[model samples]
Target: MTDLPQELRLVTAIPGPKSQALAARKAAAVADGVGTTLSVYAAAAGGGVVVDVDGNSLIDLGSGIAVTTVGNSAPRVVDAVTAQVAAFTHTCFMVTPYDGYVEVAEALNRLTPGDHEKRTALFNSGAEAVENAVKIARAHTKRQAVVAFDHAYHGRTNLTMALTAKSMPYKSGFGPFAPETYRVPASYPYRDGGVSGPEAARTAIDLIEKQVGAGNLAAVIIEPIQGEGGFVEPAPGFLPALVAWCRENGVVFIADEVQTGFARTGDLFACDHEGIVPDLIVTAKGIAGGLPLSAVTGTAEIMNAAHVGGLGGTYGGNPLACAAALAAIETIEADGLVARAREIGELALGRLRKAQESDPRIGDVRGRGGMVAVELVKDAAGTPDPELTKQVAAAAHLRGVIVLTCGTYGNVLRLLPPLSISDELLTTGLEVLESVLAETRA
Candidate 1:
């Protein structure tokens, strides 16, 4: 296990002296608009953990929101990036056209879960990828309306903000958002106001058909599992029903797998589990291992809707990110991370389900692969307990484990532990979490 580093040393309290000092500096330098998870400074990170500047090691269950799927600084990623940087940083793939960009595109096309002839357009972030997907959909369908779901998160850009359902930090003052964006109720069986998945899907489609009309709809965009909104998996028949509806209606089905892709959810893509084939798939988070790279992979016909010159950015396909992506894909394949993710899902689900059964406060325990979550509630009646969730996350942080809270109500603690995390580290982190829960209860 030493080959993977299973150390979680806490010489001082979290945000120890050094971390506090750095955080104070960061508050002045960084924008307050961006909320931080843990202010602890990273000295270095590898495998499943991050060592802070204050000499504390933390079991990183968040994985930078599922970016470092292969673990921080995998040797292959580092080697590929180092070599690529030494050669040239950015030649602007549009202008210079390097082999790395094409190779990465080829990899994405092959791996993005569709047997159809696929094409990929790489961009800088998930939002850009999402926006481009909409552009493609609109261009292909010649329609204006795009449909999203309640409790869905696409990105922070203007068009994505219009697509996003939350109103707080993402879209409080940012309106009048892009036009032609529509929202429908998602198959959130947990809190669907008593509607089943099929019912929710039918209700949503009925509403769309009434207000926007299917003929005007360009696409129906959704996250396979809503990420920022909470790790809410749809009801059994929800996604397939929606996909079929979109297919019959000529509306593009765009799966926002930015957070769920790259084996984070026990599969290469979450849509694979449902046997759903999206017309377009938007990916980011784990794509380039740790770099900022995102892409939209879709059928060649639809993706080609955008004019050749209309779908690119200056650093859309950075060589470094492409190289890292190549290595990250290879690493995921070579190390059998997909199977490892299933193992993680089984372990996490088993433990969290046990916790749920024992503690009425745990309203729900759900998620796939390493992307599991525990929703806290005040009673067995599902009264959200955001306070308890916050307390547990903070307690876990103090105990040398990093946990993140999410959901519209802020009552869910989502886990995105690296697939490479050793059994020792996984259990250790879970133990800390259980201890934190016990302390919170007391």
Candidate 2:
């Protein structure tokens, strides 16, 4: 416990002494392809905060992009990982089977929504899980077309890039993406053009029918809650309608829960909120408490459609990651992190709404569970105020708090605090945000 600082202590500016040095070194040592939010250079992390090497402690609101919901350095995750490393590092689950791999898969099957018998396949990343999901869907239906939604961010891989909506950074100049990939409008309520949930579904489905034709559609992939696309939660009834359409058309429905799963949105799986049982669900991020792991869980028939030896990668189910996943799942269940996510949502939404009342720049504050966000606007007219949002986040950073901005317009401030965050810490983070907004607006 002593490894973590009691409170924030900013001796120098944000990057401070150690972090600045590390950043300079990183510029030379690390790949420039990657992006960073804060350069605090974590020395230790637990509960709701991260302690930087510069000796400054910060209330973590990003939760490492919703990857550490159970908290960074969770005791169970640490113990399990350490034990696994001591036992054996890598035997490749495919080459030499391990109980941890099968155990984690079993957990995913049981934890994922739906009472039907399920099967699970582990992967090295969310992108891999998504790519595999498409393969399974295509194989199951014996179709060639895949339908994705706009503003979606599946991954950086070639196949996923075609499935993803954005192109500037993720898909720029790398096109000639996979064939038979089609896109439709996402259920974005804030910009739904005044259409109802069912109407939005129709708009998307109509396009699918006209362009791709349901006869050739293999899968309809969607994110229950758009993460990088501004944390946009689909309008009510939108998902159910789309899922129903898939059922009637013989298209497999795939839910990309990489960013919204593992209690990030109050439910174990975001699809559960609408009682939507998708044919396949892709999961990652918070699953292994920050470890690199992902999984595709779905109905037995759909997943098994792939011929034997058609699936499985060399490092697909690394022993270390499987151990961490087991421990992480156990931690989430035993510690009641799911309920804690609800408490976080209630506290954060309550404070953010109050702040919005006083600040007109706050266009809208919305989200579920620990995954909340506040969209900034230029004025009462509700034009995105990306500049002000960036300034507010920068101000919060200087004040020893870490915040992240999302949305295509970059005006949405996403709050993904660890579910284990203390009430006091959570309140302090919210207060910091309020203070920053007040100062920025003034």
Candidate 3:
């Protein structure tokens, strides 16, 4: 990783020969359903750059879709995982409980929003964490229905598919989804007729009361800052109001902070911004540096409602992943990554917002901390322009900058640089994006 500098070095064309060859192999061997955003294969990555198979070092603004918050192969994470591997690989926390898992659970209970008596359950993926959260919520509340929001993206499993609102790519042919899941309008400030936060909350609550009815709804799951649905930070006052309503109605409020947790959002958790402590907080993506780990943290009573056997999975808290998570959490706290995320957000958003001033194609620039986005549109009236978004991202990619696209309409370009990234490297990535936007036609 020391050899992999934090600067973008284009030794060859974007994909280069080696990457092109791997792409050919991937075409032949990999499933078509599994799509990749950047075609370049990573040979090594650290700090802010990904050294591709072709030896072209690309500036990473996507942070592996918000997973590697401590950067790829971070020292603490690497050391922890290596020591754990040397000690033992897996006993499956279910079969044989481990200290690492318990330590991670303790860390989450302490770090997540609120000073309540909390308990955490570990899982392998964000989807699993969400599923387990819903199970616990239903068990605790003794209700059957759940409510999700517009532009929401929960996961790919049947139950999560029902929770997600997108169609074309995520939920197109994947129907026969879990029943009793309802959808409500999120407080998208930019497009909601200029409704205030309280107003939007009232609108959502009214719909929930009228349509789903709190009596039948066990929980209402939401991403404090929506990820694939675009980095849509709901209007201010919106979250707290909803949390209050949920508390009054005996409905579980689940904060799916899978993308916004663990210092990725310029805070330990996005819910911290509004002081809205959800009943159950589902977290992942940036939890374990680069390891696959997710957790559901909530009040002890709600978490324990699920039967003992209902929560444990074969690899729920794999020793290696738990070790990695503990180290990642340490890095976040010891390194003051919460402040770093704020710094990155200020730098990226300052530059992008400046660029937005001249580019009418950039309809909006929105986010908090390092979790920022540029929403492309056709006109000031804000007709979504997904095609233009693709062109801008492709141009940046060709120039050795790795950016990612999202949104229910696919017109949003999200920038989630690792908190470990240097200011110079992040600025350079944003420069590439600025240039791409300048040249890209609407």
Candidate 4:
């Protein structure tokens, strides 16, 4: 595994001298808008451990925010990228097309959910893919409005910023955002007070009809397992119902699998869990190991709706990125990482649930496969406790473990460990988390 130690080794404090010095330099050189969860500087990372500039090996539970499913610096990705760089780095696909780009599109078409005739277009980030998906939907349906859900996080760009639900850091003062976007209540079980899947879908669908008519809707996009929206998994029949509604209305149902695709959840794609096939699937994170690659894969007719010269970007499918994606996809299928994701989920869920027995502050623990989270609350009453969440994450960081927090209220401690991490490391990280929770609660 790239000659790095598989175990956590603390040679210095979490952010030792080297890292602190780098942090100081970063403050001066980098923009203040660029915030970091940890102060440590990564020197090398792979197979569950991120060796920092201070030589401290910390267990990686974030996986670069679910972007390194095949593990950082996977051999296959490295070799393919190395060979591609040596041969040729760029030849803009729109200008001088290459086999790598075509191969990646073929792979995405074959792998993403449905068995229908699909077409794929690559891009640089999840935001770009999402924007393009909306564009295609609009072109095909000749509609003007799109709908998103509460607590959703699309991206930082103009159109995606409008799609996202959160404010403050993501959307505050960033307007006037793209218009014709609307938001509706999502099925948040913990807070919904037992609203059934169908009921929740009706609530959302009714709102869409009343506020933004289906006749004007080009698309309705959602995260099957909402990511930044606190990893909230919509109720059992919620997604299916939404898909049916979209079909009846002739509006495209887009699945923003940017954070949930490529087996981050137990299934390869979150929609697979519900047998839901979205008209357009947007993917990015974990698609190319760690390279900057995203795509919009959809039915051929819808994807080709845009005029011949209407779509594409200069760096949409860089050769090296396409190569990395092909290799990473191969690695995932060959290694059976999907099954590994389920195993990680079981191990993590069991530990977290057991911990919740004593700590009433852990209001809920839910997720699929490697994507898991524990919602922190003030008590059994289920009042969000974002402060406690922050303390717990800080405590884990000091103990040579990396964890992340999310949710609309920022009270969910999310864990997204790489599937490549060994069971020992996973267990140890959980142990650290449990200890930290106990201390923080006390």
Best by TM-score: 4
List clashing residue pairs in candidate 2: none
Pick by TM-score: 3 or 4, better one = 4
How close to the true structure is residue 149 of candidate 3, measured as C-alpha lDDT?
A: 96
TM-score of 3: 0.99
TM-score (all chains, Cα) for each model: 0.98, 0.97, 0.99, 0.99
Q: What RMSD does each model have against the real structure?
A: 1.3, 1.4, 1.0, 0.7
Model 3: lowest-lDDT 10 consecutive positions: 1-10
Best by lDDT: 4
lDDT of 1: 0.91
**Which pairs of residues collide in candidate 3?**
none
User: How far is 188's C-alpha from truth in model 1 (Å)?
Assistant: 1.2
Q: Evaluate residue 267 in candidate 1 and report its C-alpha lDDT on the 0 to 100 scale.
A: 89
How far is 427's C-alpha from truth in model 3 (Å)? 1.2
lDDT of each: 0.91, 0.90, 0.91, 0.95
374-400 per-residue lDDT for model 4 (tens digits)? 999997789999999999999999999
Candidate 4, poorest ten consecutive residues by summed lDDT: 1-10
lDDT of 3: 0.91
